[model samples]
Target: MTSQDERRAFWEERLAADWTETGVGYRALGRSFNEWMYRVRREVFLDRVGALDVDWTRARVLDVGSGTGFYVRAWQQLGAASITGSDLTEAAVARLRDHFPALRFERLDVAEPGDTFAGADFDAVSCMDVLFHITDDDRYTAAVESVARLVRPGGYFVFSENFLHRPAQRGVNQVNRPIGWITARLDRAGFDVVHRSPFLVLMNAQVDAGTLWRKAWGGVLRAATLTEPTGWLAGAALYPLERRLVRSRTESPTTEIMICRRR
Candidate 1:
């Protein structure tokens, strides 16, 4: 099947299974480490983007690949001028509309750039956790370039990539590159890198993507790893620890964040 068909199937499965049109709830609903991990991730990411101010009220914000409009509610809470959320999934958009009557939703395959963001649009734009699934390098480059073209000159393109730091991890989310390489890609794409960090541990794949029991055990391990100097020691003792060393100063940084402006 094609990529479009795959994403469509992913959303259809979610809608047939977990799409909720109620109050603000993330992709995951249960109050567990998984939910907390997502919340903390958003909190950290939002803070890193410096997008928490109330001045955002009514500011035109575009959320690309906005599954269930998770950040849509946030942009609204921060006083976004308006939020235009686009995704490849009809069921996801339908769910978002049922929840937020005022928000705008559009349908498009995220793998293609021009399918959405027609012109130099909006004050700022963002796409969280959506780039990595795009395995085609040429298409990925095109999509990033398209995002750049959509933003007004001088407008910030607030986004992040799970850089492919490890060559073997290439087929997964693009979460394995260094800041310099990533900055180069942004430069080529016409983005000006203003600020960036080495890495930040976003989530544990084995936990968030794991089963309930695995997550429970993983949470316990995570809790142990957060207890000050001991976690640092535990990380060192552990083998192939990039999963926990995200952006850790004591450990080699794993995940990173970059803030860039249109050049």
Candidate 2:
């Protein structure tokens, strides 16, 4: 199989085994930390998107790479008129259907050709933390094009991506791309960036490797890895600090939420 095929198979198998934290690679950080991280990231994503001044009650929403459908629930709570979640994995789609029977769910691979949603478009498309995993140049371009097509003209596409330009390997995949490269692709795909904000500024994989406190905490967590419940407490304590630091930064962050408008 090709590298892209290998990556797709990897995610399918991984999500099939554990659709929650493992699907997103949060399991290693402990349970509490994982939950806390998810909550904070969701909040940041919504906050950035909210600044766009879109009317959620009248919006048709599409969430690409929906995973376990956390954002699907968020949009529901926000009173979106319609919400559809698409995932590449059968396990994620099944769990999403079971958890949210009222919403539409589809099995989609953004890197592939053709319309996975039957030429249907939406007012907003949320493709959070998914594009970076499309590591190959051709596949990444195709995925961006596919996602852009799913958004109506003048609609929004909100996504989270790692802006760290350095070469690094995360898990079984070596998936890091520069911020300029991503924006250029999106621009070609008929999208213009509107707003961007950082999430997890202070505590991240890079920082955890070098920082003393982070290393020490990581060591403690590693020692008591089974006590997943307490991980959130540590995350809770770290949240405010991260938020404040991120807000103070002016440069590009390791990861950021970008709000793009389709032209």
Candidate 3:
């Protein structure tokens, strides 16, 4: 089978086995650290998206890669008129259906042709920590274009990525594509990136930095997080500092969120 097809199968089996919030996040960091990271994401999301002053109470929202329905809950808290959650795995869609029987959940593969809902149906689309996992170059490009098509003209697309400063960094299931290339892709897709800010500076993987000190620090944290108690303690200690960094820093060594509007 093709590598891209293998990626789809891998995600299907992976989430089918451990379909928890931590399972969709950095599982090696344990549940506490993942929970802390989600907390940080919540605050950052509210702060940034809320500042837009949009009438979310009347807006329809679509959340891509709705792992564990985290963003679905966020949109609901914003009082969106309606929200539909989509994921690349049946396991996620099935579990989300069970969790939120009132809401709609669908299986979607953004990079694949003929795998979308009615076009331009959403006022906003949230694809947090998801695009980087489309490790294939052609597929990544297609995903961006697909996202563009999914949003109405003048709608918003909010996503997060490492946005590496140097050349792209590739892993088994992720790629930290350069910020320049990503922006260019967005531009080609007819979207304007209005704002971007650090989502997590020190609490997550520092794939962009490629520094020895950063690697060593990451190693220490990963090792300490092997146990639940130590993981909670480590996350607690880092939570405050991480929040401060996310609030104060305009850029980050790890992940950052970008607010884009279709033009």
Candidate 3 ranges beyond 4 A from true positions: 113-115
> Lowest summed lDDT over 10 consecutive residues: which window, candidate 1?
22-31
User: lDDT tens string, model 1, 48-131?
Assistant: 555533256646778887776767766665667778888767777877777888777887665565545576477778876566
The candidate with the higher lDDT, 2 or 3, is 3
lDDT of 1: 0.58
lDDT of 1 at 247: 31
Model 2: weakest 10-residue lDDT segment is 202-211
> Candidate 3, residues 135-244: lDDT per residue as tens digits?
88788888899889888888999999889889988888888899999999999999999999999988888877758967897898899799989999988899999989
Highest-scoring model, TM-score: 3
- Clash number for every model? 21, 4, 0
Ten-residue stretch with the least lDDT total in model 3: 112-121
TM-score for each candidate, following the candidate numbering: 0.70, 0.87, 0.96
RMSD in angstroms between candidate 2 and the native structure over all alpha carbons? 3.0
Model with the higher lDDT, candidate 1 or 3 = 3
What is every candidate's alpha-carbon RMSD to the true fold? Answer: 7.8, 3.0, 1.4
lDDT of each: 0.58, 0.75, 0.88
* Candidate 2, 1-263: lDDT as tens digits: 14866877888898888778545755677656777677667677666666678898999999988898888877886778999999877788998899998888988888884656768779999888787777677888888888788899999988877765544434446476767777889999999998876765644454213357656755765554456656656677777877776666644335677888999
Per-residue lDDT of 196 in model 2: 76
